[model samples]
Target: MIAVDPEEGRVRLSTAATEDRELWQFLKGLQKGEILSGTVASIESFGVFVALDDGPRHPVFSGVGFITFPELSWRRFEDPSEVVEVGQRVSCEFLQFDTRNGEARLSLRALQPDPFATFADDTEVGQTLSGRVTKLLPFGAFVQVADGIEGLVHLSELARTPVETPEEVVQVGDQVSIVVMEIDVERRRLLLSLRHA
Candidate 1:
């Protein structure tokens, strides 16, 4: 078993309850939707491991939290260091948990309202937006305006200009300005267009 020591501010691994009480307290408070403040202990390909305020010399339990790629905070840094420095204090809300395994799925992105929600709040049918292609599928392309929001440009909407497949014109990472022809709230679909705009 891995044990951590948080007696002061230094972290080390020691199999002692008196030494690791801080981590235990932090872990105990992990409830769905609970926001916990932490420190970025280290980063990895899969995700970053945070040291909770609950404490310990070594990380409470290594490899406990994640910031799924899409949920990562935008940073100007050429690398992860530009935003979150090692030992930097960070706070995030829990998005999910795997009870079978003691892991917490967390998000730094959830702190703000979703851009899709903002788009719905600000616009209506006939409003226009400048969109950039993010993903290209066989059937259509996904265009995004603000971060975290995207609209699908189906093959049928690519034109009167269409010769057949979505790839004939739309390409991944292309910028196309489109109008919000329709927004289906119940289905979370946005009927987007370039030709219509």
Candidate 2:
């Protein structure tokens, strides 16, 4: 089979014998949000590549499917290999067709339940949770309340009095107790108050 993208000035050729009509129709039928299964073809520092079953072959790479680091798993990990390994089977949500690169943008994390949803269900505003400061920004500090879940403690909420920056009250890696001020479930954002805690 042969496919050409005139705008990109690229041509792709596949030697596998298959029904031309079926192949073309199958390629056209794929849509975003579809769940597909594939084997982990390779693991890279940036992402994991999957050779999807019943999917079109990629023109340049070994696999037609790719999952970025953030999409690999629900929990944060130091490396991609920590979440997936070569030859391991995985089901991923098809995020989009990377027409420019001719690969499917897959998300393995989508198949798993969101930790934020669970956290919100278990906790409410006015509750206090102990967390370590993961990042400090000019506006506020980010505290990890649970695995894969982080809340922002706004600068105004950091102290009883006005503060210039988050650094005045907290630093990265500092253990602090934070009170949940607001929980925006739709946005998946947790507004915390260090002063109230």
Candidate 3:
């Protein structure tokens, strides 16, 4: 089931298990921290199962792995299956090894560099950064400062004009200028505003 192509990011699973024994042997050969590609076989309440894409037809899977539901605030896809379907291909970073059970802990979200880490290296409070609005919520909008890093401009900080819903003053996909008010490294939260602009 596992497959690999030059254009794809990592490992991928394009078919069902044709040789479970050989696939099992290949899965045992992989080491931790390896990047993998695969297809969505099935999703359960606990996690997602993916079949590998290389010869020998291995079975590699990824779990939500870190954090809980309330912390993510993901607005959509109440179920993991809703977001990743039965045939969709995915890429993940191998994190933990569990040879005893043949299950490895994988991460899809943490694959890329952390945004806060980069922002902290190059930015400071009172600085202004131009960014695009990625998501809108009642509290604020999430602005993408880089590929994975985002800053939030609260409703009260959107503008000097009276505020109601975050969307009323700012809409998603609008590129705006924002002043960095506070950089809470401990919390990984950036406080931003457009009032001065």
lDDT of each: 0.66, 0.84, 0.64
Which segments of model 3 are wrong by more than 4 Å?
1-102, 108-112
lDDT of 1 by residue, 42-131 (tens): 775545666656534443345466565555563212455554666877788887653433446677767755656666788798888897
The candidate that wins on TM-score is 2
Colliding residue pairs in candidate 1: 5-57, 11-57, 11-58, 12-57, 12-58, 22-54
Candidate 1, position 121, lDDT: 80
Among all candidates shown, the one with the greatest lDDT: 2
How many residue pairs of model 1 clash at the backbone? Answer: 6
Instruction: Output the worst ten-in-a-row residue range by lDDT, candidate 3.
Output: 64-73
- For model 3, residues 1-197, the per-residue Cα lDDT tens digits are 13455686676654333334654466567777787776766665556666656523333434212222222222224567545677787777666644433554566655655657777889988898898998998888988766557788988888898788888877889999998888887788878888865
TM-score for each candidate, following the candidate numbering: 0.65, 0.76, 0.52
Model 2: weakest 10-residue lDDT segment is 15-24
Better of 1 and 2 by lDDT: 2
Q: What is the lDDT of residue 49 in candidate 1?
A: 68
Candidate 2 deviant stretches above 4 angstroms: 1-25, 43-47, 76-79
Q: Which candidate would rank higher by TM-score, 1 or 3?
A: 1
